[model samples]
Structure formats: C-alpha cells, structure tokens
Target: MNLTISVVLLAGIALAVVLRLKSATLTGAVIALLFGFYLADTDAAPTVNELVTAIADAVRGIGN
Candidate 1:
C-alpha cells in the first residue's frame, strides 16, 4: 500500500514536470489519465501492479 502511494506521487510529479515543460498537452494527459483509470479495473491491473512493485524493489535494492 505504501509503495502504491509512493509510485502514484512520483508519477504525479513527473506528469506535472512534463506539463510545465509543455512536452505533453493537457488533452493528452487527460486521455492518459482516463486510460489508466479504466485500465485499473481490468484483469491486467494485477500484472501491472506486480511489475511496478518488482521495479520499485529493484530500484531500492540498487542503493544497498
């Protein structure tokens, strides 16, 4: 649960930076957000979550 929140916050910050730099338009962001919202309801969500958690764990391990 904590990892999920951290990942979300990190992604939000990255999205904000991209928006500020005008690298992605508001429409594109909105579309992507909606896509994610819908995607989370599907069976692939578990696979996605596991993938993210595994990546996060690997990143954390790098410092040790």
Candidate 2:
C-alpha cells in the first residue's frame, strides 16, 4: 500500500515533467491523496511532525 502510493506520487511527478502539463501533475497528486487513507498507516502526530520538519528544511534551503 505504501509502495503503491509512493509509486503513484513518483509517476505523477514524472508525468508532469515529461508531459509539461500542470493538470496532469495535479491529477496525480489527487490520486495519491485519495489512496492515501487506504494504502498507508500513520500516527497523526508523527506525520504532522515530519511534514513540519520537511517544510522547515525546504524553507531553510532557500537561503543557502
């Protein structure tokens, strides 16, 4: 399940890049999200923490 979502997310990125279509990328993101509840297991707090960390890191990178 996790694997499927990961694959789909990756494929969507690839599709957006290769097709140069924003809509395709959006579609892919939506698909992954829809399958997320069924395909992956998570602790709500932990997930939020991880996302915050990732966002912080991404923001920090911009200054470098």
Candidate 3:
C-alpha cells in the first residue's frame, strides 16, 4: 500500500492505455519489459530507486 508503488502502478496503467490506443501496446510493452529487466541489473538501480522515492515523497508532501 505504499504511495510510491501505487502511483507507479497507476502510471504504468495509463501508459499501457495510451500505447493500446495508438496500436503499439504489445510492442511497447515488450520493449519496456526488456528495458526494465536490463535496468534492474545495472549499478544505477539504487539511484533510480532513490530518485523515484524522492519524487513520490515530494508529491505526497504537496497534499499536506
């Protein structure tokens, strides 16, 4: 139930919908999956995670 995860999932769904509307859903999804797998094994993953966490924290703070 983490806010960051929720936001990410929602964003992903939105992206998927957009891709589908453009008739590129399957191709885009496959490419994205491959890219994600590649990124996950990189040394920069921690930095990416931290950046995403910071963004989520900032967004949360906006509503307070």
How many clashing pairs does model 3 include? 0
lDDT of 3 at 23: 57
| Candidate 2 local lDDT, 1-64, one digit each (tens) | 3544465456445555545654556666665564454334444547766898999999999999
Per-residue lDDT of model 1, residues 1-64, tens digit only? 3544444455556667666778777765875585577668767799999999999999999999
What C-alpha root-mean-square deviation, in Å, does candidate 1 show against the real structure?
12.4
For each candidate, how many residue pairs have backbone atoms clashing (under 3 Å)?
0, 0, 0
Residue 18 Cα positional deviation in candidate 2, in Å, after optimal superposition: 42
Model 2 lDDT vs. the true structure?
A: 0.60
Cα-based lDDT for every prediction: 0.72, 0.60, 0.69
Between candidates 1 and 2, the one scoring higher on TM-score is 1
Runs of candidate 1 exceeding 4 Å displacement: 1-23
Candidate 3 residue-wise lDDT, 1-64, digit = tens: 6555443454456566656678566766765675566666768689999999999999999999
Ranking of candidates on TM-score, top first:
1, 3, 2
Ranking by lDDT: 1, 3, 2
What lDDT is reached at residue 17 by model 3? 67
Q: After TM-score superposition, what is the CA distance of residue 58 in candidate 3 from its true location, in Å?
A: 0.3
Evaluated with lDDT, which candidate comes out highest?
1
Provide the TM-score for each candidate, comma-separated: 0.63, 0.34, 0.62
